[model samples]
Target chain A: MADVGDLVGRARDGEPRAVARLISLVEDAHPRLREVAAALTPYTGNAQVVGLTGPPGVGKSTSTSMLLTALRAEGRRVGVLAIDPSSPFSGGALLGDRIRMGEHATDPGVFIRSMATRGHLGGLAWATPQAVRVLDAAGFDVVLIETVGVGQSEVDVVRLADTTVVLLAPGMGDGIQAAKAGVLEIADVFVVNKADRDGADVTVRELEQLVSMTRREVRGRSWRQPVVRTVAAEGKGADAVVRALAGHRAWLEEHGELRRRRVARASGEVEAVAVQRLRAELGELRGGERLAQLAEAVVGRELDPYAAADALVAELRRG
Target chain B: MADVGDLVGRARDGEPRAVARLISLVEDAHPRLREVAAALTPYTGNAQVVGLTGPPGVGKSTSTSMLLTALRAEGRRVGVLAIDPSSPFSGGALLGDRIRMGEHATDPGVFIRSMATRGHLGGLAWATPQAVRVLDAAGFDVVLIETVGVGQSEVDVVRLADTTVVLLAPGMGDGIQAAKAGVLEIADVFVVNKADRDGADVTVRELEQLVSMTRREVRGRSWRQPVVRTVAAEGKGADAVVRALAGHRAWLEEHGELRRRRVARASGEVEAVAVQRLRAELGELRGGERLAQLAEAVVGRELDPYAAADALVAELRRG
Candidate 1:
């Protein structure tokens, strides 16, 4: 086994292989995860963590790459964490993001890694904060977390970031979906990608109306959700996205919401870890034995599921 | 303040008001949830739980009403649970499902209710199985759960049902998304609604190929997902859909998969409940006290999040 301190030291020295190996440890749930996290904690909080998400085929990868280029031109070291919520059917999936971002493979100042979240162990929500810390500590000035805007868990991952960007496309199904569900509140900044496509103006107008409707005076929410347009494939309006991100960041900092948001993030992480830990401990306390009995009781209609669950909780607590 | 047994009794007698109250308790996470579950336990497992899901604009509600018509034609009492994963921005939202199913409002043999998952307490995944039990015990011969096909929690709700129907429209962009994600694996039957539209055949063929690819001899899975066509707006092809459901039901019973699926469902419910219970318990025992300290420790970089999380777990165990 590689020495944890050595790996951390090499990562701090900006060694790419060491950074990759450390992330591997994070993904594999390595035994030395506690040690690795402790060693890397001090170097965190320096990177500006930004998350980008959108429905599939909305050019999320294109926007991410363009943002990377714009950020890189400013001489900032950037790291990208692209995650696909792993599905049951697709065993060895070929992600579109990987192919889309292939041009940046040889860029030394840029680090990119792909994660497939099978929700094993603590799952993506747990693994991501730790992984972000790794990249943050490894001297990335900006860390970008991108996911296909599908699944609750995937959306939850972006919530941990300092700023969240929700992307939409024109003349497709994305605009209606964003309207149907809870997409309004999640977007700190919205980017209408594929701006060259037909009905782009309609999509923009529709989004503007939704944003205005959300930031109504009755609710008393101060921060306005800004919708920017970008043809990411052509690198058009990429600068506008970066400007919008900075504008949101400034607003967050000015309103003292950044500190509050970070605290909430920290509190959430602690709770998530605690919950996952308790779950594992309970699983070892003859949980399967008791669970089988309780489940059988439920199936036989002898006891309600709530009662069985209460009994199981008591058993684990006693253990 | 109604007695749990009384409410269950009234619900079993097809009292719409009582049924509505019981489901409201389910939604509100009423303190009497445990008692309600116990009272309704024996009367469950009689209803055929059919889950219908598809991407937005795929006509899930339309098909649900049509299916309700077909099932009611056979003199079977039917209940509907249409859930919208509640968005943070939309409070008191007017759900499309409720409006679409409005025509069946006066039908004595049908009960349709809507649930919005704000993830209060145990979340929709934990709450839904119990809710289904309530409807089942209320003497409904069939319970149909209709949800917009987005996010993992929404999809997980379908897994609790006996048969899952994945709906698709001809022109809307659901086919690619379903193919990209794991929807193919979760589907037992596919409904190609809006069959009169152009490209309906292509959509059917696409689903057929994807479903076939999933059920290879190497996997040793014998179940083949059947695709049925429907023009739900005009009530065309509803009988074919009903026949398809019955065929799948017979297949499930003959193959002994029904009992196994229910057992698995029971087991999952038990686990979900245990996890939620443990989370709440851990929240006690000076829960907020240790959480703040741990969050501070993690933020200060004195301890890595993993180590801080480990320490928090230790504190909870000690409590």
Candidate 2:
């Protein structure tokens, strides 16, 4: 097997196969993939990652495909990481959403890949941001990350994106569900996909009410998020969506929001990477023995879990 | 107005008022309360923290009340922390599930306290295990933690408990939802609560099938997770639930699982405490001018969040 460094080098040389292989290595949880990804981080600041999230059947894939097509037409290279929620029972079965974007897959200008949640607690597939890094370092102008609609954790995607577009379906619910899930605050742009559906206007009105209420709560924020309606399948509102995104890009540039977002993204990436390292190093040294002993003790009830965890950490630190 | 140390002292001296005050202090997120609780951990090993988690309205509160009644009847003192999901609109709301357990509140032998999740990501209220530690140190024979049921992240409760009872309601969409949520694996004992409802037997059969399938997939030495049917409102099958818990306890004891459990609990608690300390320290230091500038940079998009976090941590270490 080629070492991670070699794969990363090939990826930096703009080899798609090398980039794909590197991502697979990281996704498979190879021990040295982190170092390779970290080495490439300095070269990764150029690509703007846009996260597209929404409920299933809300045309997130279609919207993404349209956006990819538009970006390609504009002579910019694009990469799509379509995140699918894994089937809990048969972990092997993936809800392959890329099939919907089949038209773009064959385009040399657009690179699309599907990622399963792999049963991780937080929504974005664990390997997602790393894959984005690979694409970014390989000089993609834009990388789009589409998440499977698992409510709150979906908010996590915002940490990984320059801009987040929350796709909404008309006639879904009273918008209370979205509010309850904390989706309203995280969305940079709200897209009412499937605009041809009934209640699109109502949905937009409700969303506007939500935005107004948010403004009332937050106050003094000049950038009021715009809600755009689009029939993604017919591609009627694709330009508006693209325009709204471009407007956001301009706003970020005008207000120095891009630099701030890059900092936030970099800080989040470092923290995540650090935490993963800490957990792995600590786990390797003591996790197996401590877990076995702790599981047995928990089963026996002689000591409580809190105490066991304390002992494990203490031991790890002592070592 | 009494300090946490004083309250801990009073509670240790068998004063219920002091114990209640100590619990309140912990719940309020007072920094001193953690120190007081840690001082009391050595005296808390005797109480068994039992975690109850399941889907919303699965009668977890009712089951908890019934189990409290049973334990009280056996002359065991019990502490109940009923965690409710907080309303996103209001940060403060009534922790009012006590109405369901009204019969036990004034029983003297049963101490029932309602807790709100308070925007914590984990299902159990963040203050839950701390409160459990307070109860344990106060001489309660058992501490019961009833989580706000969102299904995911309830696994955090496993780290806080000696035994985990997963409650399931009849006709909850064919048990697929339960399996999908990954609740079935963490359960030490499965209680088909609300057995009086129709399709109870079918739910039990379905659960059995799912559990069996999981066992086959993992294929190792596994304990047969016993399922008990309960009509908690009527107090039927409450004895069976207790017996099942007791049986698991015995199994753990015979196989030396108790010691292992104790270690695990201790280790988990220690890690949580360390993380809490890190967060507190970081929050304090981030109030400085340099960190403020860094935050501005992050907000401006010049620095990524990952790098900002890294710098913040580095600055803290320097201090």
Candidate 3:
């Protein structure tokens, strides 16, 4: 209902409603999304994007709240994007999760949005990057993307960040389970939350061993990931996690990997959008009768999938 | 490598090596894939596709092995595609899991393959369907697709099946976790494995309640998903599962849902291949310099992603 330029201007001026409106446009893939993107592009690429992710019951929300307070204490504006890739019916549950951050709900310096991947064609692949851009253009000092689970989609989401912090807790599972979840390589920083609980040291040690066993280099530069201990529920060790984040950010900047990561993220975004557009074109060509016929032929064993795909692509090109 | 026609011919004769080679081609997306598809298409559309999926430690492997035994007992050839969406480093662990099904390793009537979503661009989206087609064309009467974990990718994999079975065991959370994993809607049948355990009844009742609460109709026909109790480790209740599968298949055929489901599957397969081809084209266009330039502009805040996508699509059209 509002003009794109006016919405962008108000978002940059730190109006929560305007920022929410811009993100809704991105989420819904509104027809004016191009206009919104163009209007927001000039003020983008300033926010430091950080990703925090782990398994369920690992206190991700509490840790996010802790980080928000820590960053705000330093006089910085922070935006939180909580992504739930679960079922659409879990919205009520996610609302409960979001209420855990009630202390920061009224803070003028904080902007938080929860995105669900329900009914999305690509399942957060394309929408997330654009949502991050909206937050970045809004002039937030740091944008934290928090995902609910450690599935493939979550990994892809965290990969969009300048710094990715993987949270773990005692009694969740061992390091082998964590590695099997494929979190070892994506973590720029590791937080062993619930540190005061039993087996906290064991978790830290196991993670340290796993990290050492699978040492990785970014852009041919070795930046050994550090493991920090925290009890996020009580807000203990938040500063240490913050320090670890700052260290990773500095390392990334020193290695000139930040721009490279951003470019890579942008490249993925462009590819997703292009492929999505191609799919849409294929779905729309001849009102999908061509595709339906090709599928029927394939099902009838008169044609192979590759041949069917070729025919569909040809139709798309002609269209 | 053997010629595609020769390999396909051997595979149709039930040569295990030939079957393995053909699947490798599909897995690696080899250049001769189109030839393989053409050679195998005529023999497809004959195999029954059943997808078995659940949370980890839900006895999926055991149930799959049990079903293999049951199907083989009925003189029907069975093919198993156990998809592991876990870490690539967990290959050794997966090998151990695969060895659990070693009883039929030497059976000429059974073909088994374990597919890991490692280093794949689409993460088993395109590969699994082709792999299933290979087994289908190779004279396998039934193809069972078993996926580990209940993530979004697993759900997508199971959607390719004609009958989807969601397995659960006692103490593996409750109905809510299963619902949140988005498996309830995809399941045509639910298997409560390890039914001898203490909480098995409760799990079954919870699942039944959840299924009733979320009752869905297929093409205007209401088919209530049935919950079967099974102690798969001891090979009990597998015959019941087979019966349930048969009942569902018969229902599908009677309602013409079988052809509709197959056509839908083929359509998805076509769409995935079309999208993948477009992505490959985009990656190869102008040696990717054009894409890199677009990404740099987007990252530098000079162009929005939609505009970047538009420019890339323009280049693709010209090409």
Candidate 4:
């Protein structure tokens, strides 16, 4: 019930409660929260958003936690937005991800939050990026986003991250199928997580082959994607992963890809916000009578959906 | 080099070459395609868009072909939009789904086309609903959209379909995991495809339980969510699937959900078109400078993506 402006101001002034409240407000999809988000936008753009995605149970959470620790050890602030699939029946997230980050909860330099898909069709809960924006504005130096590894939609994390790391476990069936599905191309760096598992060598070989296949297709001569193997639980390969990330940042700079990615990221966010606004407006305009008539026409095969949509849009435009 | 308007006109006249040309024009992500699509919109709304989605190798294409056959047998004309994952290497779709419908290509009443995701970040290819509109205007009574089962983004099917059937194969790891992931809730009718496989009954029962759980959460009067078992290869349960669809149509009418779905569907199409248009325009206006700048800032860690995006939008507004 607090004024959103005041809440945003307090958050900018380092009030943790205000940051927490703003996150909840955005997550709830409250209309007023958009204004708060917009106000806080000016203060964002300081956090390094790293996307962590892989097939389910690939130790994505463990990797995220390890990264968080590494980031903190380097004397940098860290934020984690762990995305979990929601339970449709209860409309609540299992929230198991936060448990993985238990060590960092009490650390002032760390902020960890778990987000549910929240009925958004895409793997991302619509509010996930908005929440990320809030943290960035709050001065977090590193933001790690963990997606439920369901594939393509999960790759959307790339649009929001400065660097995207695709995690893969050893012995997953059909490695080519997974790569062919579009995940392989989105990775700035690949991590063969759970390397202690049997057949890790085989998975590594398959990933290398897939990467090679992708490299041949790329038009440019400069970009070289690297696949790194990691036993995330034991932290055996965390330093290499970090080094690969740093190398990617350097490559992005040398090639100017980082600038392009930032522009694309911005464009994506603006478009998302614009679409959400349009959907809300359209929903309000669809009065019961028009909807019922259109439904009847569709059921009776009297009108096609496209025609119905034209009529509705025409009506909206007229008003 | 023909104008898009001319191509769309030819497509409307049932010229296969024209239809194919128009689809290519749209897929090319050209600005003129919006005008061409707008011209085609008036003829759209007549086709019933049905969406088919499930995990890979669940036989979505086979099931789609069977449905098309049934609809054609009933003297209804059908249009098929099969969206294949783009080959990451070539940025072109393999378009092999037509193989599944090899039996129906020559049927006068059945029109089948395959669409590649075409670098669209979202699962449903950006050109999809527009292609469906073209098909609708071409006088197809039913439009079936088959999406690669990559999850979240594919769920966008529900936004585009009057009836959405989620296919599930028997023994797909954990049925409860699938159900809890929100796929169960999007389905109007649950299908246990590959019913001949072991654990079919178990999958069916788990789906029923999941649906019942959702029903309880909504606190609505108890109504059983129907599950149809189908071995799509042999067409053993195609008729039952058809009947279940009809039943869902009837239920929608009774509950007014059908009308609601139509409005939602129409609005969704409009939003898709509007967003696509806006993105194209934005792309042209940026002319690659803004994107390049943002991507660079991201790599340098000099700016956070969210803030950079907010700034870009501000800059765009100023321009």
Candidate 5:
């Protein structure tokens, strides 16, 4: 029941409870969510947002833990958002992941949260950017958005990041499948985890070849993606991965791609919010007799879906 | 391009090329999509929609083929919409499945199409029901919507069906995992495929228990979902599966749930079309300087995302 301003003040003062409360509001789509977002707006845009993603069994959780340790060793407060888009039903599929990160559970400098879509209206698109804003405003130096599975929604979530790290293991499929999944294009830094395994060199070579093949240029400057090798379970290659992240960040800044990326992300976030608002409006209109009648007519084959939609849109406009 | 009315007339006369062309228009979100939908509306509401979904390796393709043969034997035309929400990148992932169903390629009574989301604007939501309408209007007696994977999007696609069949194979996973994935609640009929394989009995029993434990009643009538056994590769138990589908359809009509379900489906179709229209309008607004300016303000932290969304929605209304 505390005021929004008080919560934001506490969150900025390193209070994890206050930070968690703000994100809970975002997740639940609380009525006062707009007020909270407005209150936290001025303090955001300071944290570096990085995205981590890969297919299942790629040790995404382990690699994320290693990165957390490496970042914390440098005295930087970190925020972690582990997103599970696949487990919309249980919302408990990530419990094992949270348990694996138990070492940092008690550290005040590290804050971790797992999010699921769970049949929400706008799904991840509506909640994720707001959660990132909350973490950024909470004074976290780095915000890592780690997602499970390599679906389109996962790619959309990772695209909100300034830098994206894609993890792959030796035996997990070939680099071709990853390319087919569109991960190769979104990855700013590629990590071949479990580098001590048998096929580690092959994975590294494949990723290097793939990255070299797909040359991308932004604003007349091209940044060749670097593929790093890591044994995340042993924490052997965390520093190198962190260095690659830093290099990509610096390159983005120098080329002015960072602001452009942020603007694009903001544009998507704004559009998702606007669409969600219109969806809500549509639901309200449905609560009345308008949508039901149109649906009845469509079911009766008296009105087509597009014509019904046109009528509904006209109603929405009239409102 | 030929006239949409001419295409609709050809489709009604069982010309597969016309049917294919109309569905292509739906998939591409063509400018004349509304004309096609409007033209096809009156002839719809006759085909029975059956949705089949489960995890991979469940022999969904084989079962669909078996059902196709069974329905063709009864002198009925059947249409199939195979949805691949996972392989959004490689639309070619389902090429093998399509080739597997090659026996029906020459049959005039059978029509098959595989659809992938592939970065579309409305995704499966906006395109699927319209595709179903196209098939329904093309004089197909039964429309089968078979979806790959058990993700939330797959569930949403299957919800458009009058009777939803959830396929499970022996040794795929336990019933608990299926329940956790939320497929247990959506099944009107459960098929335990590969029934000759080991553990098929246990899987069937587990599903029966799960179905019985979560009994659902609509309009004071309760229909217990039947779990059927099938060795789809050998074409065994296809009759039982077909019988189960008929029984469920009969029950749906007797309880008036058929009309209710169709109305709900129409409501969703209309809502998706409306939302797609609004999204297009938003895209137009984004092309102007208004959305870009608001996004810049959001990135600069001068205006929050919610406020930016409000401005965008206001602009959308003004349009």
Candidate 6:
């Protein structure tokens, strides 16, 4: 472990390697995380974190690359933290070139990092929020965190971004099934990607209605959610998607939501880490006599899981 | 707050209202869950819990309906837990009046239950496994737990079943996307539903290759993964799915994997409940001076979340 001061300084100086190292430290749960976070705090919160999530076979990666091009054209330094299933199959095929991700291979303004889930209960683990913090502090103007599927974990993933873009492809039979999947609640911007496909217009119309209905269902929201169309294979409609994101950002700031969202995001990250540590503490007790007895009691139905959990928490606290 | 004994007795008599009441008790986190579990324990371990899960719009409900017919024809009492995204559109359309689900509402041999995610991080949640206990103890011969998609939560959903079936439709390009989505690891049986559609053979071939590859990758599996094709809408190949599930169950029993899987499932349910209770305890601490101070410390980076979490857990213990 190098000096935190040097690493922070290098990261702030826009060194991709240094930025990557810092993110690694966070993901690896470095013992000095407190110091690292404290040191990086001054350099944080500038990046507009955007989350791109949808079902598989949707043009999530394609739309992402297209958005990357548009954002870069506008001269914004971008960072991407792709959650699992952003594999070479999805992104690399659309991204076309994965020679090397962060340095020496791609555009200088663009930085790409792929995250693989290590069988974590939530797809976005404790590491993702921390890693996002690293990218934020490293001065990425707009950081993109892309994940597949609109499941409960996607809701958590929304915590990593200020604006979340839900991508949908046309002719999936069930129009806007993304909303049905509970993603409508968390999405800020919806992208009907692969707009060149058949039934694109119908999909767009359905999304318009779904977005409005959901927006009304969720009361007191000052910002209206917008649906944008994209055909990322040829990069058409990519600029509109970027514009929509920026518009939402502006709306967030105008309504004093940006700071509030950041606070919520930070608290969420804090709570996630807290839960992770407690789980770790529990795992640490697995081989011990206490957990075994407690598990036995639970499995035997002599004690319900909640009651046994209370006893286990009490025992862990004693330690 | 009624007598736990009375509730259990009524639930055991196959009363729909009693069954629904028992499930509600679990979902609402009833304080009497301990006694309820103890009462139900004697009747469990008899039901064959098969999990059917896959992407949305894969005809899960249609397949489930067909399975109910086949299982009922075999004189088996079946329970279905459709875990979310089982839209009324599918169940009611293909099912033709989802009034009470599956073969003329008054059928006693089939019980259909749908579990919705109530903002739980994982789609399955604590209520699900406990509800499964309620159903199992109610003497359902086969409990089919169906969930949608391959999110992290779906992985958790797999723990609730002895055999997990992965359903995929053909022409959803990249024949093995299900494998890529982390479904392969949790799948024991693969069903390429909508087999009458074009490219069905291609999808089956791809899944066959994927199953073998994954089997080898996983290592030490005594039973082989099988791919079954079905056009669930017309009830085509429904018996084969039922047979495949039975075969998997038989293999599990012969290899002594069934008992192991049950133990694993019970332990997993225990762990999830414990974690949920701990989280609830933590949530209860919010707005208190201690939690506020700790959250402030973490957000301010004065203390890492791990240390703050330790203090919070210790405080909970003291209380």
Scored on chain A only, each candidate's TM-score is 0.91, 0.88, 0.96, 0.89, 0.97, 0.87
RMSD of 6: 4.8
The TM-score of candidate 6 is 0.82
Better of 2 and 3 by DockQ: 3
Report the poorest 10 consecutive residues by lDDT, candidate 3 chain B.
Answer: B85-94
Taking the tens digit of each residue's C-alpha lDDT, what string does model 5 give over A1-319?
6899999999999999999999999999898988998999899889999999877778999999999999999999999998876632334557789899999999999999988776878888889999999999999999999987535676678879999998888977757777766777788999999889998888888888888888688977888999899999999899999899999999989999999999988888898889999988987884677888999999998999999999999999999
Q: For every model shown, what is its TM-score relative to the native structure?
A: 0.85, 0.75, 0.92, 0.75, 0.96, 0.82
Given the true complex, what DockQ would model 1 score?
0.36
Displacement of residue A236 (Cα, Å) in model 3 is 2.4
Q: Write the per-residue lDDT of candidate 4 for residues B23-108, one digit (tens) a residue.
A: 77666755566566556755765777777777766778778877887787788888888776443321223256676578997776
lDDT string, candidate 1, A93-144, tens digits? 3275677788888888899988876535667767788788899999999899
Q: Please, what are the lDDT tens digits per residue for candidate 6 over residues B1-319?
A: 7787888888778777788788877766777887788788777768899887766578777777888888888999888776653321122232232442535357876777766665543346567778888898898898988765544555567557899887788886646556665567777898888999999999999988877776732235556688899988888898898889889888888777776677667666766766776666676674545555665665555665556666777666766
lDDT of 5 by residue, B1-319 (tens): 7999999999999999999999889889999998998899879999999999877678999999999999999999999999876542333556789999999999999999988776888888889999999999999999999987535776778989999998888987756678766777788998999999999988998888888888788977788999999999999999999999999999999999999999999999999999999988887884777777888999998899999999999988888
Model 1 residue B161 lDDT score: 91
Best candidate, TM-score: 5
Q: Residue B230 in model 3: shift from native, Å?
A: 2.0
Model 1: lDDT equals 0.80
Q: Residue A148 in candidate 3 has what lDDT?
A: 63
Candidate 2 lDDT, A107-221, residue by residue in tens: 7667777765544422252467667877887788899988745423334654468888988888877365677656776688999988898889988988888887775222343
By DockQ, the better pick of 4 and 5 is: 5
Worst 10 residues of 1 chain B by lDDT: B85-94
Model 4 iRMS:
6.6
Residue A97 miss distance in model 1 (angstroms): 3.7
